[model samples]
Target chain A: MNFPPPITRLIQHFRGLPGVGPRTATRFVFALLNKSEDELRAFGHTLVDFKHSIRTCKECFNISLQDPCEICSNQKRERTLLCIVARPQDIQAIEETREYNGLYHVLGGVLNPIDGVTPEQLRIKELLTRLEGEQKFQEIILALNLDIEGEATALYLAKLLKSRVPKVTRLARGLPQGADLEYADEVTLINALKGRRDI
Target chain B: MNFPPPITRLIQHFRGLPGVGPRTATRFVFALLNKSEDELRAFGHTLVDFKHSIRTCKECFNISLQDPCEICSNQKRERTLLCIVARPQDIQAIEETREYNGLYHVLGGVLNPIDGVTPEQLRIKELLTRLEGEQKFQEIILALNLDIEGEATALYLAKLLKSRVPKVTRLARGLPQGADLEYADEVTLINALKGRRDI
Candidate 1:
């Protein structure tokens, strides 16, 4: 009766999301209230579409509208070279660079025991399958975050891939430690890509 | 090809929102990617329902699913006292106090000419109408923000209401300047309500 009850429930749902506290959640709910019915419906549809219309690329575990994804289907990209990233957004960051024309492998997560995320829990098995298959990758570039988890994941991947692949590299350390690939400036990404060294 | 071109559009849309920048937007998009198809659809449906189900109260301009709103319809509420707020969320803050059982008036927005919002743009006319009928308000509390704009709006309303209503009181100013009522802690709000003095 006070807030129509449903609005309160919606605010609570918003507050459940990461980084959204009670105040921010309340603001967001009211902001939605300010929107016209059409706009609100559109927002809801977008959220639904984003969830339903999008799928993970079966090949790279990257987000897409299809199974294999456009990148996986494209013949122009170098299948011999694969870039390893922690999340789908990291792949987007690298794609924006327009430097690498290679394929990608999304790990889905980093190796963090504290969070109970292990390499086995990630898409590492898929990467291994791709590497050991008839289509062999000549190089694997680790483009994960520069944080502790990223470093640990990269190191674990490097150790795993070094014995299998011809070459294994990580994004250069010129990138500030603890920086996310998604947040790194294009210039920094380009620099890191160009200056990448053997890891 | 990498992340589905439409994903970029969604991320850009999120970044355009207030307080959401590129990095946070990417985080949100990736979090979306982690959700299952059903969850995504539910999120979308919630958004759409949020838009479709909610309506502004006709009399007080408060966000609700009803016309007069539950608060306005409640028989137990004090009809002689009206609490004026800048937005719908402000009403929530006042309700949490349990001290006030009066009906509410949502101004919709403060007077900000720079953004091209005039007195006519808000619910001022409806407020005046509410006070004009045989059901008159004994005290009209201006519980708006304490910022320059809020102060300006309150002053404008006080002057206008003085000739119409018997009493036009404002929420006390011990509340930190520029602080939003929605963000103020319960103790501060309660104290402000307790220490309220006549303007």
Candidate 2:
């Protein structure tokens, strides 16, 4: 029942995650124990490297190696349209469509009252500051999930952007309620984007 | 969309696991990235330590910090009873029950001919060696899963052990069919153990 101190500690650490339980943590740690020293080293080094290398983009708050982020800095991308997403993974979902040529504003999280995640907890203030008059975005699309918190955040953003932007839109319905934007199929996401209605 | 070289390599490594997909790999890497530097170092060090610290017990084939394993070396354990399991995790499961005071023999893996895991590939030879009568066992319990591979391994071991030992038993049918032993609830597992039937 007694694992080596390090292995026990590793399982405890893995257990700290949102969905990982002690049993799953044991499975994960044992899998690591079965791996070769080189494999373990690679796994360990990757942990450090991921933390050291990936940083939140200064402009959009999306995870990136670069400061401005590739999406924010790309000249070929549409500058007059901005898609507001909740997380970095959400940005990847949008990009996979190959349809949304616009830049992104990653809020880092949705507004969840139970979690004490308010407007200030997200990158909302940073997002407002980044919206430039010279850049002149004609549309600000809220491509957040269809969940309650996602809806609340999108509604807040839509109302706030309505006064400043020419058009404020949210992705069309039928995206499988309470699910993640990441879980949406590419075609469904693309269709949702194409059929986005003004709020 | 673009991660650094080390982060990319780490995600690829995570993707190499049995059930992990590319998106899950990305999420896992990012989750690691969220860990503090000290935590990251701990995570990395744990992987290396778990692999380096654990060794396969020469007698039982169970992974442990010692050669004979804590269970094998313990004097108070029921030496006349040995539990045959498919993996080290199975040993951990039984140990957690705190009901079984018997020694254990890990087969390392079950016999799965389709996946090329033959009887010879398992620790059947070591198991046979342990039955040589100097420290004779009254009973050998086959605690392997009730799945096809597990059943095959148990039946093979049962045939071999029945010829050599006075009694050969199996964990009861209380366990749900096809589910992993590690996932069995503690009460159900305890019942299964207590209700063990002879083959």
Candidate 3:
């Protein structure tokens, strides 16, 4: 189909985003075209600033606006209690509970060798370094997904943290299997938090 | 949930897109953040150019890189055969069939009174002007969707075009009701084309 060059290019660009196929990409382009001139320019400016404005925390390896992130920098946080999760968004899910007042380690993703995601590819080194640093974390919690990849990652990290940290624990079997921590309700996460047991 | 400020802002921006909700927007933002820096920058550049690089055709009101749009400007197109569609993407769906060699007029959207969309709000005036112009369109095809709004708009246009053009027809009622032309299969459109009846 001979869409005008610029419109076709715009659709292709939209398709590059995750989960957006050809039809969705075309829909996005049309939606953008229908927007007001000011709104379009603002959206473009936001896109330009999106990558530039975000920073990875030096300690937690989470996406944020600052080097250490607000969660890592907050004085009230229980620095001795560290919770490790797969992705940055998982931290939001955990934080919403207000049940655990601990620091975090964002792995960015889990260990999935089939998908070419290895331990080294994740922020595992950073997690280890943070544990080794001045912050004497007494408890390290593995708050990962209940899937095969998440299980493998948990086992690998648990083995590593057990020798160094005073106590190493997993989020317990309360969360339904195959569920993402990012999408889990606060009650479910809270239950998992309360029932957490040492690995 | 308290996501990092910049990350949250990016999620909100993505949620503004059609068909995207809170969860999908968050997922899109995370996926984008996972992309390589160069790819992210290139995507930003494309977004900036998206609105700036495109123009509306003076004659058809369709989005294009040029003033009159490629379809309206092409001399080889059947100047007598004009296809009226709801949006620019509809034109792509129709063009995919390679069945219609006519020009198009994009109404931007169909009239929905409850949505405050009146005739004056759409490109109806431009469509009427085209009918009154020197270019004698022998057949004006109302290729709108099969929805209530689409049906209403097509009927309105058909009534108006019947008096001006030698022939005014609509795509056959072969399409399923409430289906968007943008998502209709090429085969469906082709069948509708073959069975078109006079309005």
TM-score of each: 0.81, 0.86, 0.82
Per-residue C-alpha lDDT of model 3 across residues B33-76, encoded as one tens digit per residue: 76887776667666666677788889887777889888888898
Top candidate on TM-score is 2
Comparing 1 and 3 on lDDT, the stronger one:
3
lDDT, candidate 1, B53-128, per-residue tens: 6777788887778887889888899999999998888888889879999999998899999999999999989888
Worst 10 residues of 2 chain A by lDDT: A46-55
DockQ for candidate 1, please give it.
Answer: 0.41
lDDT agreement with native, every candidate = 0.81, 0.81, 0.84
Question: Candidate 3, clashing residue pairs?
Answer: none
lDDT (10s digit) by residue, model 2, range A128-173: 7777546788889999987789989999988888888899998776
The runs of at least 3 residues in candidate 2 whose Cα sits more than 4 Å from the true structure, single-residue gaps closed, are: A175-199, B175-199
Tell me the tens digit of each residue's lDDT in model 3 across A15-81. 8788899999888877777678777666666666677777888888777778878888999989899
Q: Lowest-scoring 10 consecutive residues by lDDT in candidate 3 chain A?
A: A40-49
* Candidate 1 off by > 4 Å: A51-55, A175-199, B5-17, B51-55, B175-199
Q: Candidate 2's interface RMSD, please?
A: 2.1
Which candidate wins on DockQ?
Answer: 2
